[model samples]
Target: MTSRPRTLIAVLVLVGITVSLQQTFVIPLLPHLPTLLHTTPANASWAVTATLIAGAVSIPIVGRLADLWGKRRILLACLAFLIAGSAMTALSASLGWFVAGRALQGIAAGVVSLGISLLRDHLAPHRLASATSVMSTSLGVGASLGIPLSAFLAQYADWRLLFWTAGGLAALAGVLVLLVVPGRSRPPGGRFDPLGALMFSSALVCLFLAVSKGGTWGWTGGVTLGLFAGAAALLVLFGAWELRTAQPLIDLRVSRRPQVLLTNAASLVFGFSMLISSLVFTQLLQMPTAAGYGFSESMFVAGLLQAPGGVCMIAMSPVSAMITVRFGPRAALMAGASVVVCGYGFAALLHTELWQLLVCSALVGSGIGLAYGAMPSLIMSAVPVNQTAAANSLNNLCRSLGTTTASAVTGLLLATMSTTVSGHVVPSRTAFTTVLLTAASAALLALVIAAFIPRRRPATTAGPLLATPTAVQRHEPRPTP
Candidate 1:
């Protein structure tokens, strides 16, 4: 209700927008980066993959850091990373520099986690759900809006303008954060778990590299298999380290709570389902019309066609809050996943017409808006206040895991199930259908998972964290969404 909270929320939303926009800036230029940066296409692909891997590794670490250090301080640090990366990218003259800049930009994705935790710390309990909902979906909103805007800038202007704008906005937002966002809380005596972060980050990088590059390297190839095996090994070590550490990166016991555990499982599923729309639908709209089921649209037009989906996400934020308030976040998540399933089902059946695809996208977007908005509330409902940032970050990591898996699955299916049309290889209708069905199935799986999340209780501060190795955090009253 005060000017301060309102300003803080606005500035953080702006940071979210800036962060999401940075993620997509390089996308429009990927096909041409080989020429632009004088590199091989394979090397150029790292521009995208680097950001993905960086974002995944940093999400959890930054969340824990925010809790241990200070939310506002860590947030400002993330903004600085974004601004520096953006400016570096804008000035990049080689593939190596560009990839490095992109990696730094990826680390800024933690601002979303910090923003949610900040809201929890700064706002009244009654305002928490709606504020967090809006903050969470801001990424989707920026992403949806960014796709077309970046495409336009890359085409019409010096492509460097995209990064320049990104840096400028991030700088403005950082200044606002320093002026408007107030207060910091760090529980005394908790140490930063650098070893835990290193093990986890290494595991994630290997896992993401294996998943993202498997199609190019052959799924059964030695390098791909090695990375997967290495990831599994590192993760086992990471878990053991967390269980033994005095101040672990993630509290494994607290994480094992039914609410937190199941929500994370469903978050991964939802992430897979949500991203399939982005990967599958955009291609369907851009393939040559001679392929018999294609629209032959420019990348910009295709992005424009899907723009409604992002709009629907923002439009549904308040609706998601209302649903969470009335029936609980579990119900909202189920409703959202159900909508995604229905949308994917329709896409599987009736994607022949342009309007039909639009309808499918709108439905999926609305569903994702509802689902994404509710996830934070669900995690917050289960974790101690000190661990809110860390827990939410882990949930986001699960979603990222789902997304990387989805990317692999869709890439694998499309590559294998292809046909040569007019002397050029093209993904067959069967591939598209199968991808849609797989996404729908994932959403359906999330619905099944959501059924088991226990109803929340009245709001109470979460119990003491990290008192001992065998400590039991409160399970009965973290408060339902």
Candidate 2:
């Protein structure tokens, strides 16, 4: 790789890390938000939910806009949102303002997909896999680091300082990107699909709201059921409309390709498997020792224990790239899923010790690194160059949906299956075991789906690219198969 590409990759990775950190930085502060903002816990929860909903809605839109406008322009706009949101959160003294700021921050969630698209546009074909792998791994790295970083800041400093720090980092990323990243490509021209965007966004919000709040609102309650039903109906309509539109927001035709379809299916399951380890292990580590399975570690300690997993993810990026270069992204994905299954199985059997949990987390993180690294390679291989951002965004959206499903299902299980320990109701050992087994099952399913992904022609072979509506051909051969 040239020095300029290296610099561009570094800047994009830093931007990816910054946006990801914003996603989790407020988690440790959730419990205190009610008191700090002088609001009820139910209302305070929106601070988190706002970010999630906004992110889910923004991803595809930003991606489409990037394709319509330019990658760098959209990226700078995302960073602006991040910086402005961080500043707003830092300065806010009320719940409404805080939630609004969080929603703005969520707009930056598409940075990773945009970064991957940017790499595809600018980097050499040989360099694309490694660069995208590193970019993909940045999501895990930022998430893992955000927990401890936030916990420490919440404990030792004014919590608002965390947002200030986020703002500073985002500002730095913007400066670096402005200085080093090259100018934009001529974006394909098309009318903005307002109707399509509206339909998709509304459906996503309804679905996500149901998933995020189903437990708190009672899953059988009118509001929860109504949201789910509305989401389903809207999605069906959205699909119908998209199929007939001339310039659809998401080209269902392209999305239905066997490789694209199966990779997305696998991505959803992989997302579920990834979140299961985090949700289960965090609670297990912090539960009172009297609970039989608890490690009774402090939040910071638990966070630190999981930090090595992020390191493992970063370390696995190059390895994942090498595997993609040698065998194929499909092979790398299946291998990663298999590793995740083993990790979850290990946790199911041997989570009694802190070291065991740490090992399991690291193992799972390694699998996540490998799988995530391969997913974009798979998507980019199948999609046109111009549509790369939108396609990658859809893949990322699938993963988010998976995480949401995992959170809902696991929350329900932990809530219902509990044991009394010193007058406190805690999730029983069986609950943890069940969740782990479920996660393992999801990984096994992903492996199966990955196995069916059609092998691509080797990068050395010159062949016609997969056909799409836009008919944008790849400038280089597909990644090795």
Candidate 3:
């Protein structure tokens, strides 16, 4: 029933803006680089790929650092890094320099993780789940909002202006984080796990490279095979190292807890499934007006159509919180997952019309709004507070991994499958249906996993504490929201 301090909400919004800006700004500019910078499409593609690789590899490392030093401080540092990267990008004339700037921006991608952990640190108990959900959905919101703005600017304004605008936003985010968020508790003399970071980063980089380039490289070709093999080996070694270390980078034992593991698994599957709709819908929307079922809108209009989904997600946050409160995190999650399954089912059945697409999008958006909100609560319920940033980062990483996987598979399927409908080419209906089925199946799987989450016995509503805090929180009752 209590309200969270507005300062914390401000910080979350700033984090979302900064993190989303890094990814969204480059999208509208992707094809232009060939002429703008005299670079090949292949080389320019790295501008996008580098950021993703950096984000995936750096999240856990930066998250661990946030846990060690301070989440707020780390967040500020990331913003600073992002600002510098944007500035470099703005100034760059060569593709290589621009790529370097993007890579730097990628390293700071932990802002979202740090923001989620901070919510658990600062928000009121009754409000935590809802706040977490909004924060999770910010990723979607940022993407939706950024794409159109970036496209408009790239199409009309100077390309460098995009970086300048992003730089200004990053600087503002850094200021807000410093001015608003509270300081973190000093960890108990734990050293940064450099070895663990190296191993994990190496694995993620290799794995990501394989996925990002697999379509171009041929999945079984030398580059993809080598990267995949190397990634698997390093990840296995990283797991072994973590189990042996006195202060492991990630506590595998805690991760194995049902609440932690299943939420993460669900996050991965749902994240991937969600991307299918976005990708498919975008392609469908942009297909020439001559193509039936295609709107053939300009960049701006296409972005606008999808933008409302983010708004829908933000609107659903409060509802999701109420659901979590009334039915527990597991039930809330299962409900959300079920809704997403139904969303995909609707999409599969109703792909022939525009209104049908909009309805499916709304269903999927609302369902994701609920799922995103529930994940943080589930993780915080089972893990230690000091590990929150790291744990949350891991969950985000899973989602990212899922997204990357979905994109790769979708690309492959669309490339291989096609049909001529009324003499106009389009993605094979059969291929698209297969993807919808896959998405629905993933959501159903998440629902099944939600069933196994351990229940916390009922508790009185009067306490400042949660029913029972997680392991780290038991020591100090770390702020729970």
lDDT of 2 by residue, 33-73 (tens): 99999999989989878988999999999999989898888
lDDT, candidate 1, equals: 0.85
Q: Which of candidates 1 and 3 reaches a greater lDDT? A: 1
Q: Candidate 1's residue-wise lDDT over 276-384, tens digit each? A: 8777877888888899998898878877776898889988888898888777888888999999999999999999999999899899989989988898888877677
C-alpha TM-score for every candidate = 0.93, 0.94, 0.91
lDDT of 3 by residue, 1-481 (tens): 2143666876776688667766877876786898888888888988988888989988898888888888888888888888899999999999999999998888887788888888877877666777787787787777767777887888778999999998998887777776777774564346788899899999999999999889988999999999999999999999999877767788787787776888899889888887777778767777665645566767656555666667777887777788778777777788788988999999888787778878888888888888887787777776676788999999989988888888888878877887776686677767777788888888888788778776652332322223344434544332222
Which consecutive 10 residues in model 1 have the weakest lDDT in total? 463-472
Candidate 2 runs further than 4 Å off: 1-3, 457-481
Q: Which lDDT value does model 2 have at 194?
A: 97
**Which prediction has more favorable TM-score, 2 or 3?**
2
lDDT of each: 0.85, 0.87, 0.79
Over all chains combined, what TM-score does candidate 2 have? 0.94
lDDT of 2: 0.87
Among all candidates shown, the one with the greatest TM-score: 2
